[model samples]
Target: MMLSTDNHAPLRRTPLYGLHVSLGGKMVPFAGYDMPVQYPAGVLKEHLHTRASAGLFDVSHMGQIALRPKSGRVEDAARALERLVPQDILAIAPGRQRYAQFTNADGGILDDLMVANFGDHLFLVVNAARKDADEAHLRAHLSGDCVIDSLADRALIALQGPKAESALAKLCAAAPSMTFMDAGPHEVAGLPCFVSRSGYTGEDGFEISVPAGDAERLAKTLLENPDVMPIGLGARDSLRLEAGLCLYGHDIDTTTTPVEAALEWSVQKSRRTGGMRPGGFPGAEKILAHFDHGASRRRVGLRAEGRAPVREGALLFADATVGEPIGKVTSGGFGPSLNAPVAMGYVPTSQSALGTKLFAEVRSQRLPLQVAAMPFVKNTYKR
Candidate 1:
């Protein structure tokens, strides 16, 4: 949700900027691009619509890269990629995607990313903010035989919610065949597209990557569906938060390890010490130790007692009077789907259980909080 443009630089615009403006989208500078924060229907309605029906999001700012081996072997490229991250990349089948994180030497996360086995090459979708650093890391460590191709000519868009699959299948007949985390190339609306049955809103959806020149046409074609509406950054953040998804710089960073962020599931069993392929990526020792001995602090879900929504950086305490601070809220907000305030943050391992009682200091008042299970709402993925 960190979308502020640099003060000195000029703001950029996506290919669908004109369409957004024509739809009465309120443009705001975010991550160097002038993006829509909300449409005429506002953030709350957009958020609800995504859960009830479908929503279209212009995510062209995300970075897309492809790793191809000069020798034309998929295993060669997958093995080369395993050197940078602690994920079982070599085991991923063609047309399947895996969630992974780039770790540092000190067992901290550089960024969380999605890696897809696109048959002949590995496709990656990295964060818009950390794309430069991630690309630099890949180029610096990967073998010379592997080539890195940045797809600057592409534009990415996500169509999310319950009706997403049916709406999209009308245009691309093969889209509905893909299950969760499956990705493949198809012609959508008569345009070449790489469609992934995945999204951050905990819904059944697809993230479609199309040519930059054809982005507007693809978006307009999708919007013609009554189930689909344009959603903006404000709703994007709220939806992901309600789904308990981490917002890169805020929830997980270079200082936070995958174990501490409660993302150990992303580190596949094969990547661990006793599996088929083990201990090859950065910080494997320290990261693996957390699996043997639990981390000192762990991320957990928090549900506030009342309706007063707590925001990020709110101090957390064990007692209402606050003898000492225990943790801080990383992402917190009102979940339109749940009709309640939900938050996620790191707390001492002792207090990270499913129903531990806690307190959050918000605006100089202590609010009672209970450590609860995440995904404040249920995930409706097609898997």
Candidate 2:
């Protein structure tokens, strides 16, 4: 659902543009880039192939930023960032990563991003669509002691699936030893790179950040292995949807709060009551209140009753098809991994329990829906 629509304006291309085209990538406008929606093997094959083997993904369109404290104190920079997000940045040790979000004054998410500690500085990777706004917000709020540097000179690529370890280990031995969420510098094929043991798919993988000039060579080097194949945006969407991961604009947006989005677990313990540091972030009062007393509505996974895959914006109704709508699907599609239609939507807390039934008003038909548990496909993360 984060896909971009075609327009008269020219679309930007990543450094891997020629390589994607060489591999017969079906390029489309996405997040301001002419990204591949799928390869010649197609979305279904790409999805299944990623689950079974390894899939190479060009994610350079994402924004990568680094924050350094001007003052000699590293903890000062961490504290300054903590003031913008509810997560505990001070607790993230060097070479480790944590998920966080920038919230508005009303506790609604501005964007979800990954924060990694690099000893002297903190590295942040934000969504492409909101990168400019996120950078401005950080500058506006963060104290003058901290400096934000956008890493426009780098490109990011993800090698994901069961074979990700062995494939990457051939290039960098340190890769396989890293557990999920671990990030650090590594040398790959004589190239200096930063490899993170993380990815969007619910699979064991590595997201590598390399110099923009060398991105194509790095990608080609990885593709030389028989286990890896080029994956595109289409399979990426279905894979994440099946894994129950929230998309930036679809599953989460400015109007949806963290509590209602079921992302309370990301909030660090130190930020909550009875902790060392409490209530310093933006929207702390309203967000923490919902933590104590749960939100009236909560995001839940839904399973449609037939072959038809319910899609985004499908209205949901309770009991019968004719009544006031209860909720609507935020992200939905045919899950290639599950071989069934899976979706995520917001519903009343009363009807959020597992096994509770609802109806999705899709194309004038009342499709039976069950409030199912998330991650329709179990996560294969390297814990």
Candidate 3:
């Protein structure tokens, strides 16, 4: 879920807007775009359908950018980008993508993004709400070394589920061979597109970036498959929540650091204190300190003891009668796959151990919850 911050700005429409409307999608404003919240199948069935088969998502509102190095070398672009994110962009091999975050000088998260090495230039897919700020950040820092090209004419769609590979393979012969995180240009449905064997859903899938003009045709062709269905933002949120994936602005934001967010995995050893090129990125001091020592708070998975879904912003406490909120839920909902209420939140490291019991205040009642392992539903990524 994308949130609309500015109510005055006219909502932008994606290339597949017509298709979504024709398919009976419930339109809503999200991140300044008119996006589908759900279809006639409703969020529950759509979420289950994706887990059982394939689900197509219109993620065209996301920003796609190309970082072309002035030296005509991909390494230069990678190195330039490394200055912004904590991830080791220099080691990313061609046709592979890696998740990363942009950190602030105060060690807070600016935004999280995916960086793909395209051999010649670096490709970036950033959150819709932060795209403008992200582009401005790049221009402010790396303008002299790289050329930033915003791919506004492109539309991004995700085909995700157990049957994603088979469905995509019918159109793109190379789909089956692409492993997790593999990203590159390919002929998808007779249209030149950038295809990545990765998605927000924990299921095996592909995120295809196509030209605006051909997006609707490609989507229609994909939906022609018996196993594929058009998914909306509602199911997308619940699906990702069940998969233990983070949603920008909610689960993560400028107030949260990558270390506190339990995203230290994205920070490679090469960027750590002892490595060859360490501590150059923004907030290296504070972030690395958290790595060397530890963060006071940690993001953990929560399983509500009862049926009540502990939604975001619910205060967490040590007991049913609480003195103060120790933390707050960042993302939470009923997991359709798990058939239970699941949530994620930050808490004191002391209270973040697995199986540690806690309580969440909801509607004047402090309900019981436990610190459980993530991915309430098992992930099916083709790793």
The candidate that wins on lDDT is 3
349 Cα displacement, candidate 1 (Å): 0.8
TM-scores, in order shown? 0.98, 0.98, 0.99
Candidates in order have lDDT scores of: 0.92, 0.91, 0.94
List, residue by residue over 1-383, the lDDT tens digit for candidate 3: 56687889999999999999999999999999999999999999999999999999999999999999999999999999999988899999999999999999988889899999999999999999999999999999999999999999999999999999999999999999999999999999889999999999899999999999999999999999999999999999999998889999999888888889989889999999898788889899999999999999999999999999999999999988948999999999889888889999999988999999999999999999999987888889888
* Candidate 3 residue pairs that clash: none
Clashes of 2: 0
Lowest lDDT 10-residue stretch of candidate 2:
1-10
- Show the colliding residue pairs in model 1: none
Total clashes for model 1: 0
Name the regions of candidate 2 deviating beyond 4 angstroms: 6-8
> What is candidate 3's local distance difference test score?
0.94
In the range 1-383, model 1's lDDT, one tens digit per residue, is 78675788888788899999999999998887899999999999999999999999999988899999988998999998888899999989999999989999988899899999999999999988888889888889885869999888899999999999989999999888999999878899899889999998998899999999999999999999999999999999999998999999899998888899999889889888798988788888989998879899988899999999988999999999949999999999999988999999989999999999999998899999999997889999998
Comparing candidate 1 with candidate 2, which one achieves the higher lDDT? 1
